[model samples]
Target chain A: MSKKDKSFEVLMGELETLVSTLEGEDLNLDDAIKHNEEALQLIKLCRERLDSARQKIDKLVQSADGEWQKQPLD
Target chain B: MAQLPELNNTLSVSQITGHIQHTLEQDYGNVWVKGEISNLTRHSSGHWYFSLKDSGAQLGSVMFSRQNQSVRVEITHGMEVTAHGRISVYAPQGRYQLIVDQMLPAGQGDLHLAFEALKKKLDGQGLFDPTRKQALPPYPDRVGIVTSPTGAAIRDMINILSRRFPLAELLLIPVKVQGEGAAAEIAHAIEIFNQRQDCQVLIIGRGGGSLEDLWAFNEEVVARAIAGSSIPIVSAVGHETDTTISDFVADRRAPTPSAAAELAVPDKIELDNRLSNLGQRLQKNILNRVERHEQRLNAIQGSYALKRPVLMINQASQRLDNMQDHSLRMVKEKIGNYGSKLDGFEQQVKALNPLSVLVRGFAVLSKPDGKIIRSVNQLKVGDQVQVRLSDGEVQSTIDSLNSKKK
Candidate 1:
């Protein structure tokens, strides 16, 4: 999935599901390896999403054109 | 006559007044009076004197300065009030009046009524349905706050949000949280937040206040606005004990403005810990998976087929050699039997040889004409006779014939 579409929750959910499959008894060697790889990718994505976040504040303003706009909450 | 001073012995005014005073004090002591206050007067001594009057009658009352200070409601003329105190008679005036120790506005009217009415109306409309509450996003990109621009509530919320989750952006839509147009202003701010896409959540509230001060939050307009907002709204109006209509209708209700700030976003420390935990779990789980697979691989590699391959080959070759030795031994035994049979046949042939019989001393006789004669008459003509023995041939035909015939 695209990074924009991959919410932390969704990626984490998929990662958990994959981990369980990898831990399951029925998974063959090749499939387990594949699941492990995918889980790592999800972890990386989630970590990046968390680490890169920065806090901000904004003020919402209405323009003469009858549209809403955001300005810095100075 | 002197009949007990006319049976209704006219008592002295002092006696009658004292008796009346005693009766009034005893009977009307610890009384509760409910009426509207009129002729209210605040004495220069910080005392209050008011007449608790309804349409029918009025009772004079006095609350000492100490008592007035203790009373929660300001005693105002025309305000309905309930007065509580001991009733004592002003014996000189022959009137009984209450010495008021406490007074309360008969009901927490206006604001309280408005709050209740709005709550009921909204509740009937299902605006306060628990199921209608939106789930706040675990991680909101931005939050919109509808509150006063400069207030303790805002300060508290800002500090909390910054410390809790710096990852979240805040959208502060400053509005009056009390007074004349506060309700409309709050509603407008909510609408603005709803129209904007930046804020995923909203916190609309103010600090603690008296019911009147907190009336704006109880306003129907604000309640409906909060209920209608697309973004989830957390209402943190007044203190913990206070509940406003907005509180009922909002997606979530925080007891205080500071609590609202806490509810707005997750604590960064907690999120950090959680993420680290999740990372560790992932690592451990993946490692376990690898370990299991490695074990399987080791098991296969340790199997007899894969291990000790040279031993297998040696065993097969050894069996082949054993078969070869067995085959060779069988062939040799058969050949020896055949050789023994051949030897016996050769001996038999040797026994039947004529050369061997001749060597046993047998002889043959023959005439000179190369015909052997056995009869004496044939031998009479002894011109020449020849005899053959095992060693040599000889002729004695005449002598042999005479002796045999006699």
Candidate 2:
């Protein structure tokens, strides 16, 4: 998969794993923290990708309007 | 009115009784009687024997097991009934009795009819829909109970609630649960509990009894009160088999008053175990975090960059030393070779000097006017000239000279 799609898949997988782990209530403190950290990173990456996509859409809109806009996606 | 004289060789007692029984059976065939049933007995063989009586007259009745099995309504003592049967005589005892085959209730009270009509009406309204019922709270903060203050249901509710979940507060709203105006009183109690806002769940019920005893709960007022309450209500009226209108309209239905209490709260032991498990999970998480950080720290400390701090510096220093030694040797060799060649060139230049040539026994001839003499024609007679020798110079005047030969 492309890097963006791969990241998205990883994020979704981590979310499912987190839900199952929390629901199962069998995780040790260590495992919970590790999973939590992984979930947080996945969330951050997903958010970043979403923000980038939003910026790209904004750029497309501005280009359609024939305007030179300097928008930085963070 | 017979006037015949009795003889010693007359008919036996059995024959005489059979004759009388046959006559009575033929005379009173297929009769209907209305009377109160008394001394009712149900034999193990499923037959019924009872006496149908008025204020003064009474008659024995027998319902065969086969015919009695078809009786839909319950036959009980003190119940007035109208029965259709054939009057027959038993030859063994010569007793005449009614052999009933069909029966009907002589009279039904107004209260019983009203109870049945209300029950049917409420049932048709879908008030007893199980899908509309709400689940009891797992842990109610406060439980409100509406019943008679002296009833057994309240006691059962309180006992079960306290034993199962002592943390829950019980709020009892004492009201008459039966008889006249009991329905209104129960409804008012429910309204009061709802308006107070302190109770999270409500239980409305009473002990089990006959239809009349539970008529209050069957009332429309009580059912509407339960349905209108904002709080979730659990109806536990009467026994498991007895149903009331309030039970149908309430958010939940319990088989008994004690069961309602059990449903309203959760077990404390189970909750405690859960909390402990969560605590353990938290600790494990913290320890795992620490271990991961320590592993990262060890990895960093063991990295090559830190272990060999002077590798780059040593290599650079050695290179600089080798370059200096190489440059020094090159310069020394070049300077030494160039110095010897320069000394030889200087010696040749000195040998070509005029003074050195004169020293080697060569002379430069010139006229007396200090000009070098190249030909005799250019020289004048008696011209003073200076001559330089290897070790000295001579002054002389030239005489006239001619060129004799080339």
Candidate 3:
């Protein structure tokens, strides 16, 4: 897998694991710290993915020559 | 016959009917009858009375509480049934009736078969697998509902979800839930929701209804649509006992549409309580960790290595003490040596004492005013002088005065 894809997978896995861990009781401090760190990493990865996707969409929309246009945020 | 005498005998209807009832009960035993049921009535006394009819004839049937309790299928009009009972006469009513002992359905209905077929088809596709199901998001950002816009189910779901989790955004994907083309519309709505990505979770359902009314959810198209969606779907089609293929394919199945809403979103109050609990737990964990580290630190600080400052300082203290003793001894020795040198210098000074000079017997002269006369210029004509040897002095007068430049 590409780095982005790998990161995406890891992000999703980390999110799933975090949710499961949070659903349970008896959390160790070490585990909590580890999960929190993982969640932060996943959130960063997701943001990056979203930004890249937005960039790709913008590029596609810009290349298209048509009356329909994408509007820019104020 | 001897009965010919009854030509003149009078008899009441009840009396004659009781006589015939006694005679029929004595003649026939219990028998089973196959016929179509009609005009069924259930009395408050837990008894069922209906007319059992064939194409050629009809007869009244009665199923008492004791025998009716064993029948599983409901007795409805025009139901083909086989009933086991004995033909009996009602003495009071003067009417003949069949007392049914047992009954069984003779054929399956079209709707029941259709339901089973749909259930089997969805089951074969692993759509009903519990492992393939995704859990509902604890706090969905948006909840999409697929149903009739003006339906009671929608209203119920809205009311429930809003009351339970008011923070969630609700989006309605209105579509016909019944009649022709409803299944297609529902499928299209689900696809649209998936494409829009406007909802975190989807609840596809309608309120309770008859088999035909809820048939849209049982359609294969709707079931596949639910199963194929990227977003997790919750199916709540009918009453608790009612099942549909959509329910099977959905990630979660709720008994009713309102229940599906409840399942789709969590109660804000409960979540707040849980978050507060988590906060408390986090605090407790941190405090316990700090306490444990503090105990370890206290144990380390209270060790013998730290408790006794002398242990660490003992070598330095000993070195200081040794240096102090050595310095004191050197000072004492220096003092002794200085004392001897001082005695030698004292002896030398005594050798050069003026008293020793006096013991050498040098004579001295002085004037009477206590002036020493060292030359003849000191001797005036009227001056008085004293001549001194080493121990004594003599007073004398000068006869002449002389001036000298020396």
DockQ of each two-chain model = 0.39, 0.02, 0.07
Q: Give the Cα lDDT of each candidate.
A: 0.80, 0.73, 0.75
Model 1 docking tier (incorrect/acceptable/medium/high): acceptable
User: Would you list the rank order by DockQ, best first?
Assistant: 1, 3, 2
The per-residue C-alpha lDDT of model 3 at residue B51 equals 98
Error of 2 at B128 (Å): 2.0
Candidate 2: misplaced stretches above 4 Å? A1-74, B1-43, B47-78, B81-113, B280-406
Per lDDT, the best of the predicted structures is 1
Q: How many residue pairs clash per model?
A: 2, 7, 0
As for model 3, its CA RMSD to the true structure in angstroms is 13.1
Segments in model 3 whose C-alpha atoms lie over 4 Å from true places: A1-74, B1-36, B39-45, B49-109, B124-126, B304-310, B318-378, B382-406
TM-score-wise, the better of 1 and 3 is 1
lDDT of 2 by residue, B101-212 (tens): 8776764234544555777787787766777676666556667778766767877877777665565567676678888999998898888777677768888888898667
Clashes of 3: 0
The lDDT, on a scale of 0 to 1, for candidate 3 is 0.75
What tier of docking accuracy does candidate 2 attain?
incorrect
TM-score of each: 0.60, 0.46, 0.54
